[model samples]
Each structure stands twice: as structure tokens, then as C-alpha cells.
Target: MIWQPLLLSLKLGVIVTAVMLVITLPLAALFTRVRRRWLALVESFATLPMVLPPTVVGFYLLIAFAPTSPWGAWLERTIGLRLAFSFPGIVLASCIASLPFMLQSLKSGMQGLDSRLWEASYSLGKGRVETLLRVILPNMRPALFSGMILTFAHTLGEFGVVLMVGGSIPGQTKTISVALFERVEALDFAVAHRYALVMVVISYTAVLALNLLQRVQLERRS
Candidate 1:
């Protein structure tokens, strides 16, 4: 029972981190190049997840996934996919809740990049995509790792949004955090302690590794 929820949380974290990397990379690069006015709006929108309460985001997502809504109706009619109280729904909610962490990290990395490197890549006849791949990405390894770690960690501990969007369906939407809550509600203190300890250790280790990596990266650069 404990292993099931732990595995589910791990799976969700991996999927969410992978998806976030794909979506945030190019978006962060775009933000780095855009003018200040547009960049401000984009940053605000991207960072809204961090600013807004998780329940608020979950509430709007619930509305969007309600059967009466156009999106929900269309999804059900066309693909037979339901977002409310589903595994995929929780994944989507986790992605949104954790978006700002990945985006902000990558964006900060991009912004901190030396402009001369971009100029040099262009002068060497590399196109934008080529330069981004060969020059920018290689230099942003620290940020990439940091973003992935934070996103994965955040998703693993997600509770409010997951509860609102996925409920506590065992083996489907019941991740470790949900399981922990359930265990506590059932007054299973021993099991809840185990789950909480595991989460705390995992989260702490990931952050510690990220910090050490960043320090090494800085030392290498200097």
C-alpha cells in the first residue's frame, strides 16, 4: 500500500518534470530575448502559479474540466478523456502548479548568459536554433538541472491541487502526499510518519544535491 503511492508519486514527478522541461526551455529563451514591456507581461503570466493559491488554480481547473464546460464536453465527446478526478488531471494540475519554478529558473539562467556568446555563435554562421542547442543549452546545464530538480520535488509533494483535481482514488490519483493525508485522517500515525519521513528525506536530498551542483558549477566557471 505504501509502495503503491510512493511509486505513483515518483511516476508523476518524472512525467511532470519531463513535460515542464520541454515547455519551459523555449519559453524561457523567448523571454530572454523579448523586449521589456512584453517580457514583463509574459513573466507575470508565467509566474502566476507561484503567486496564486494552489486551491484557486485547482478551482479554475475544476471548472474547466467540468462536464458542462466546452473543453470537458469536447474532450469527452471526441477522445473520451476526462480531466476531473483522473490521473491525467492531477498531472496537468501538478504541471501548472510547478510551472513557475521551472520557468523562472530557466529564465534566470538565460538572462544571466553573456550576450557575447550569442554574438559569437551568430558570427560563426549558426542559426538561432543551432546556437541555442550548441551554445546556450550547454551553458545552462546548472539551471536546467535546478529547474528539473525543483519541479520534480514540488510535484512529489503536491497536495492541494492534486486533491482538488484528482481526489483520493487509490492507485489512480492517490500519490504519496494524498496517501499521507489519508493515513493521518484514518489515525494511522505510524504509517503517516513513515510516509512523511520518506518525503522529507527525498526532498532534502534533491535540494542538497542541487545546491552542491550549483556550487561546483560556479567554482568551475570562476
Candidate 2:
């Protein structure tokens, strides 16, 4: 029983972390390429979901996903997908909640890059997109890997947003954190203990493994 939400959380975490990496890479690329003046605004927007209370983002997303709005209506009409109280909805929530981890990691990595490297790439006839994929991402691998682990762990603990939008739909959106909360509220410490311990071990081991990998990468590069 406890394993159900635990596994679901893992699945959601993997999906969200993967999507966040894909989305943040080019979005971070835009920040590096575009006007410096717009960087702060872009970053603020990207990280907004991090600072805002989860319920606020959830509330707004809820509104946006409602039947009336064009964006929500189009999503439903075009894809036959509904964003409320679904696994997909939880994934989107995880994406939003974890956005800052991805952006910040990518941004910090970008800042460390030598300007001359990009110039050299252009001089060597590499295009922008090609350079990004081949050169930039290679350099950013360590940061990107670390960011993904952080985002996955953070998404596992997500509650308020999941609560507001996902509504504890078992086998669909009831993540381990939500399940833990349910057990705790019901004074079922025995069950909650099992869930919490699993999460603790998973989070600790996953992060430890990533950090070790990062250290190894840095050592090899050095």
C-alpha cells in the first residue's frame, strides 16, 4: 500500500525532472543570448513558482485549466487532456515547483563559461543550436545532473500544490508525501513511519549518488 505512492512519486519525479531539464536548457540559453536587461525578468518569471506559495500557483493553474479560458479550453479540446486532478496535472505542478532548480543550475553553469569559447565556435562555423547541444551542454553536464536530482527530490515533497490541484486521487495523483500526510492525519503512525522511512532513504541515497557522480566528474575534468 505504501509502496504505491512511493513508486508513483518516483515516476512523477523522473518525468518532471526530465521535462524540466529539456525546457530549462533552451530557456536558459535564451537568457544567455538575449538582452541583459531582460535577464532578471526572465529569471524571475522562471523562478516565480518557487517563491510563490504552492497554493497560489495551484490556484492560478486551476483557474487557467478551467473550462472557460482559451488556454485550458484549447488544451482540452485539442488533446483530449484535462489538467485538473490528474497525473499529468501533478507532473505540471512538479515542473512549475521545480523550475527554479533547473534554471538556477543552468544559469550558474552558463555564467562560468568563457565568452571566447562561443566566439571560437562561431568562427569554426558551428551554428547557435549546434553549439548549444554539442558544446554548451557538455560543459554544463555536472550542473545539469545535480539540478535534476535536486528537482526530483523537491518534487517528491510537494504537497500544497498537489493537494489543491490533484485532490489525493489514489493510484493517479496521491504521491508519497500526500499519502504520508493522510496517514499522519489519521494517527496512523505505523503506516506513516513506513512511508516516511522509504522517502528518507530514497532521497538520501539518490542525492548521495548524484553528489558522488558530480565529484567524480569534477575530478576527471580537473
Candidate 3:
């Protein structure tokens, strides 16, 4: 059906965004607090995915997830989960590809916080966890929103990495971008136009909302 790939893309985006949020939030918080040289290296590594070619990341991931590799072998033998060309596999790939978008946005947000807020919370006998939940996170709403939107948008448009890792398994790994590519190759211009138009609208709306959010945050700060 025409809606299958679009729906699958939405599903992939949501899952990838949720996973990145869980994985990147703590990392971003920690990065904002740390200043060691080694931490800089770690941060650089975390952002490398954004700079690397998608196919390069996909190639390495493909090898790592191959059944002959130790990690893949152990995963299969222990839990009977095979990642290569599978839904979970593409999920992991999308997570990696989208990590920097979420991480950088959140880290910037965390860094933009005034030091006095958390210090004030500490002086008031609030613990780190309490301050993070009540004070820190509440202040970073713009960053959170921006990160989620960016991650979801990026995942929806993922093609090279998704194709290299998951291939074109319909109803499983065939996302909107992948489906669009297939349509074009098959010369199905009408269907391809539909997919392209949807992506454009979604991407523009997300960016516009992010811009408005930033403007509002700036206005409130001033």
C-alpha cells in the first residue's frame, strides 16, 4: 500500500527519537559538567557519526553485526537476536546516526543553563537528582524539543545508512527514504513525488517549529 513506507518511516523516527533521548540525555548532562581532556576525546568520538559518511558508518556496522563477528555471534548465541538486515538492526543504526543531533542539542542546552540555578538548588538542600529533575530539566525544554525534532527528522530521511544496514525489506526496513529511492529507480515518479512532498513538509514544519521555540526561549531570557 502507499501508506506502508510512510507509516514505517514514522514508526522508525519515533523509536529512534525515543532511544536517542534515553541514551543522550544523561551523556549530555555529564558532558556539560565534565572538563577533562579525555572527556573531550570522548565527546569528539560521540560526534564523529555526524561528520562521517553514512555509508562508512553503515559499513562498519555491517561488519560488526555480521554473524561471524564476535559481537554478532555472542548476541545470536546468547539471546537468539540477529541484527543484520533486521528491524532492531536498523533501529541501532538509526540511533547511531541520530545520536549527535540529539546529543549536541541537549549538551548545548545543558551548557546554556546558569550555574547559579543548580547551585541555588544545592544550597537549598536539594540533591543532584532532585535538582536535575526539578530545576535542570525544566529549564532545558527548548533544547529537549529541538533535539527530539531534529533526531526524528534525521531518522526519517536516513537512506544510505539504512539501505546499507537494513536493505529494502518491505514492511520491516523499507522506510520512506528507502521507499522513495525504490520508486525513483523503478521510474514511479508519481509515488516518488508523494514521498518527497511528505518529507519536505515534515522537515520544514519541524525546522519552523524549532526556530519559533528558540525565538521564544530567547525572548524569555532577555
Per-residue CA lDDT of candidate 1, range 64-125, in tens? 98778999999989999999999999998899899999999999899888989989999999
The better-scoring model by TM-score among 2 and 3 is: 3
What candidate 3 gets wrong by more than 4 Å, as runs, is none
Better candidate by lDDT, 1 or 2: 1
- Runs with alpha carbons beyond 4 Å of true place in candidate 1: none
- The worst-scoring run of ten residues by lDDT in candidate 2 lies at 60-69
The 10-residue segment of model 3 with minimum total lDDT is 29-38
- Candidate 3 lDDT score at position 92: 98
Task: Estimate, for each residue in 120-158, the C-alpha lDDT of model 3 and write its tens digit.
Answer: 999999998788879998889999999999999999999
> Per-residue lDDT tens digits of candidate 2, residues 1-222?
768898899899999999998899988888877778867886888889878998898888877776677887899899998888889888997798889988888877887788777888999999998998998889877777878878888888888888777879889999999999999999999999999998889889878978797789779879
Rank candidates by lDDT, best first.
3, 1, 2
Q: Roughly what TM-score does model 3 have, to 2 decimal places? A: 0.96
As for candidate 2, its clashing pairs are none
